[model samples]
Target: MSDYLPSIYTKFLAQFPEVAEAQGAVAQAVRERTPFDERTDRLLKLAMAIGAQAQGAVKSNVRKALQAGAGLDEVRAVALGAITTCGFPTAIAALGWIEEVAEAP
Candidate 1:
């Protein structure tokens, strides 16, 4: 796991190992079903999170995107680009979520 991931997330995965394994398998299955490369897939997911105005998902996806080698600028662009379809408030809120992960140690 990336160092930027929140401790709560890691602890939850640890505390619920079986569920975490299941979720990991599901994530791998989804990745296998995708034609997009890892970086592209992660970026698209981040964009979707932004559009959905899901703060936690935004943070998670931002961390995943960066772990998959996306630049912070690319992540920010995805959130900001959501403004057109998702509106300013949603995108702005998502941007904050992205920053929370992107700027983390």
Candidate 2:
């Protein structure tokens, strides 16, 4: 049992002490598998961030994406994919995130 599960924020952390443990277990269970490269995952997450207009998360994930193996062009394509699913604003935002990461040291 660790601490801090996303679900806990909306749930019984105060009422049930054991809920914290359970939530941590759930998070850990989901986190244990490193099924894909982290950078690739970050790139995908960045696209999600764009769709949600979560600029901070997008910016952070873009850096992680570049660190993983995501190319600028690849990131752009991902953004384009988001356009079909999420709309143009999301796609453009993702592109901006990619560009920001590309410019970073």
Candidate 3:
């Protein structure tokens, strides 16, 4: 229900309210079960999104990371560090995606 949620995702949630509720519950459960703090969790998700080469996920995680108090440098470091594990192209693309959210006013 966040205004910042992508329109497509909002529509999907609206169309499948029950599924959305279940998905939200699962996400909450995972967060509660995780040992990592919110900032670390978001940063790890950002790294995974970079590895998966998912632009939207990368951007979303970047925003979440920032909200969780991650510094800009920390976000950039995660993307840059992916170059060795995820390759240069994936890292570069993720950096761009990070910028899209990080630089937004």
Using lDDT, give the best candidate's number.
3
Clash pairs for candidate 1: none
| Deviation from native of the Cα of residue 11 in model 2, angstroms | 26
Model 3 pairs whose backbones collide: none
Deviation of model 3 at 96, angstroms: 0.3
Report the C-alpha displacement of residue 43, candidate 3, in angstroms. 0.4
Candidate 2 Cα errors over 4 Å, as ranges = 1-30
Question: Which tens-of-lDDT digit does each residue in 1-105 have in candidate 3?
Answer: 122988888999989999999999999999999999999999999999999999888888998999889999999999999999989999999998888886677
Evaluate residue 9 in candidate 1 and report its C-alpha lDDT on the 0 to 100 scale.
81
Q: If ranked by TM-score, best first, what sequence of candidates would result?
A: 3, 1, 2
Candidate 2 lDDT, 1-105, residue by residue in tens: 112233544466667869778888995676567575666667667777878888666666666666677776777777788888988877787787667667755
Clashes of each: 0, 0, 0
What stretches of model 1 exceed 4 Å from their correct place?
Answer: none
The RMSD of every model to the true structure, in order and in angstroms, is: 2.1, 7.3, 2.2
